[model samples]
Target: MDRFRDRQQAGERLAERLVALGYGREPQVLVFALPRGGVLVAHPIAQRLGAPLDVWVVRKLGVPGHEELALGAIAAGGGRVLNEEVIRGLGIPAEAIAQVEARETQELLRRERFYRGERPPPELGGKVVLLVDDGLATGATMKAAIAAARAQRPARLVVAVPVAPPEALREMEALADTVVCLKAPPDFRAVGLWYERFPQVSDEEVLYLLRVS
Candidate 1:
């Protein structure tokens, strides 16, 4: 709990641990940060490795009545991952997905413009793509992100984060070539609790980081 005093500190710590993990040269590596908080953790990492840092926007589909529960998630490039189990068992109609998609799609486009401006996403066709997020909770959103990224045909996919529940980490491990999470608390309650400073990352910050760093 006292390991990091704040998000910046946590980012530094994660970078140090990652450097030790030996993923190789920063310039050659392609690092994708999930905005907006993930960018905060990833900036230090990108700085350390001299890698080009960019944001990968992904949004979750909240269940119709239970917003906290993820019914599915969607990512860029027509990438989608649906909880088939929920859809079949809970009887979520297509109308529900359509509604969620409409709302989430608007935000996704807005974020793309807000975070990337005119810059285009880097090529991931044959490079090691390191996906960074502040932390993992339900694993739903990241799952969609990873699946979305994989469609771009990156040679390798790695998931990096500062903290996540052990179960979530394990689920992610199978989805990615590797996982570089710094801490896996058994009883991880929430991503915020793991961080000493978990302030809400702003839209301007995401745009700024993508532009300069």
Candidate 2:
């Protein structure tokens, strides 16, 4: 059975788990949502915990013909993580890496501008940074986000998701100080399969959440 009705319900239920874990009581807490769908999953959590919410843009660098297969990812403030094994196995060239990075860098900047206007990104130093995403797949995007959050030197770094495959959750634990995945079903496949009403989150909704929530 699907565990969540939608992103909002997932966020609410996830927040309850976080609160039980004592994150809701922590000082210097900041919720950073991986934008678009993640923002939806983050909104209610941030609201429930009274933590300030912000967006972190991470772009996936997909393998050239198989665009869905991520070779690497780029995060805000020039943070990046590359999959050396994938690159070597695919024999991807350095030039291709540079090209993909450059393109994603531009897209990252565009998202920041569109989302925040003239406002600068929130500071992460000395804070308990909660990285929220709807779910984890290959985890490339969240890995880049973890690197980016680490660059800012947060006091603590955590990753929270509604559902994820057990293997990916285990791998993410090495990068994040705490990983709170509500569901880690052994038969995991796509993230959407665990939600009853999964749908594409629009840019307008992301902007609205930032402004209103």
Quick one: best TM-score, which candidate?
2
Candidate 1, 16-128: lDDT as tens digits: 88788786453458888888888988898888877888888999898888977788888765667888888788899999889998899888888787777787788888888
Best by lDDT: 2
- TM-score to true structure, per model: 0.93, 0.97
* Residues 1-213 of candidate 2: C-alpha lDDT, one tens digit per residue: 757899999999999999999998897899999999999999999999999889989999989888899999999976788989999999999999898888889989998899889988888899999999999998999999999889999999999999999999998999999999899999998999999999999999999998877
- lDDT of model number 1: 0.84
Supply every candidate's count of residue pairs whose N, Cα or C atoms clash at under 3 angstroms.
0, 0
In model 2, the worst 10-residue window by lDDT is 74-83
The runs of at least 3 residues in candidate 2 whose Cα sits more than 4 Å from the true structure, single-residue gaps closed, are none
Residue 74, model 1: Cα distance from true site in angstroms: 0.9
For each candidate, the alpha-carbon lDDT, in order, equals 0.84, 0.92
